[model samples]
Target: MSRLALAIPLLLLALSAHAEIVIGLVANRGVEETRLDWQPIADDLGQLLNQPARVVAVKNEAELLASFQRGEIDVLRGSSKVALSAVEGGKGEIFARLALTGRQTQYRSLLLVRRDGPASLDTLLAHRQQYRYASGNPDSTAGYLIPQYHAFVRNNVLPERFFRSVTVGNAEDNFRALVERRVDVAVSNTDDLPKLAEKYPRDYQQLRVLWQSPPFSYDPLVIRRELPAATRSRIASFFLDYGRNGPDATRAKEKLYWADQLDGFLPATNRQLREVTDLQLYDALFRLALMPELDTSQRQSREKLLYRRYDQLTALLGGAR
Candidate 1:
């Protein structure tokens, strides 16, 4: 072969060998914080699979979906809502679910208000136009979706119509709003409550849970469905067996648990996410009812349809309360 021909093939081989396996982490924290938490897992996967692995911090669920569509992310870890959305969009499949230490595979969203505040679910409902509310991003499962469904479809109290104002932000922003008495109510999850309490004991001490949503499954670790079979198998094996065996098991367990607050990972299949999928549907209907462009009659129709769908999904999941 000619020297140019030989060089061309060799360069291609080197490029292929160095191709990075990008794992997308849903950003619940700052990019630096998320990268620090997930880098160990990426590094471990690189060693196990003998492939270059890196973690990409996705700013939000929308960005995560967009990245998946662009084929920028090979693996994903985030809320079950995000996972189900990716699967429904034909972009990804569930490969594993995190098992938190001393925590179930499920968690619940809590509606909170200051213990001494004049805000309670009842007071807010009574004084409809007087109370402000804060919630997480629209894509958040525990933060926005579940809480919206619980309030509107389940209780027939539309926040947009009832509350004085509604603001959407991340957990920290929402909690801070509530703590500073800027918002009358906020939504947070059980998993995050402990951390908040630990971080801000005084603010947390003044907070009280006004309501709790039905349990939701822990987020799933997903991989793009278009990835090679060998790559999928290798990634799955790493998650499934991580911290469970080998001489370095203890160190691996500590690293994963301390960094990500997960005990380990368990094998998961798409079928196991039916409830989450249903929740996503419920979230969509709830959001539709909140559209300001919708006429009163149109909004009512959407609310009625949402209530019916909620009942149907709850029946399938053995009730939401």
Candidate 2:
């Protein structure tokens, strides 16, 4: 056999392997539309790279973060909280950040009560003795942390003193708790309530937005660092170009919020780690102090856990080896 013939076949095999890269997409809660309406984005992405794109629905932020650490996912459409964590861990790269609009492109923490109940934050505060409080998750920014921060951390309304009881769960669960009278006041985000209402009109009709918080930052999409630079850039370009409109133009129009549905992702400048830094600082100053620790080891473990994320982000972004 000729050496040239053998080399040609070997090169063809290598090219075949290169062409079949499977892009893993991790889905968290917010992109509910993406899971239901996958065709346009997936097809567009597939057409762009000429490779198969698979969307994997992840249940929560923890699962999404875990998958990124194990190198199981190639791209993530996630919350600011989770994306920033991925950025800090060095497991992913930030190609573009999502910009959500409404009262300054920021989301507010809302405190909701039953439709027939007291109508104000102070009213809820005074009646804390008579009602239970439910928050999305302890670690959730809009659902639990921010609301509690304002109510307890800033306003001197302690969790124990404000509510007769407290529960932590998913966003849906928080709303459910309020509707079913499981809790009197449920803390959640204003941006999320619309979708929740759209899904369950009856239940939603019974609740009202009692209080809203100041605008916080929007979420960003995190791409796994191991992906080829070309692929990363292409994905970013695809989103920048068609994320707001084109394929599922009508639905995409509804989803992207700017005046003309032109609200698309914008690239991060300065590679800022501000969100993660602020969160850690807040977690330490507030959340940590609120916890009842069983041992000093747990505290150290907590620090290491957060640092591990930072190390991963640093390594992936080329800041760390």
RMSD of each: 4.6, 5.5
Q: Report lDDT per candidate.
A: 0.77, 0.64
Candidate 1 lDDT over residue span 1-321, tens digit each: 699999999998777666789988766556777788788888998988788898888557778777876889988887766776787677888888888877468888888888875555666567768778887777777777777787555666767777889998766777889999999888888877776787789989889988888887777888998877877898899888888888878888887875667788888877666766565666666568558899989888877876786566455434554
Clashes of 2: 7
How good is model 1 by TM-score? Answer: 0.83
For residues 1-321, write the lDDT of model 2, one tens digit per residue.
Answer: 599999999998667434533333333233454354444455557777777666665446677677777877777765656666676666776776656544234568888888798878777766657888887654356665666666556665668656788887666778888999898888867666776787789999899888887777655667878776777788877777654546665555454542212356667521544544444555455555456753677866776776776665454445632
Error of 2 at 95 (Å): 2.1
Q: Estimate each model's TM-score.
A: 0.83, 0.73
Cα displacement (Å) at residue 76, model 1: 0.9
Runs of candidate 2 with Cα error greater than 4 angstroms are 1-34, 100-104, 127-129, 157-162, 243-263, 269-273, 287-321
| Each model's backbone clash number | 0, 7
Instruction: Give the C-alpha lDDT of model 2.
Output: 0.64
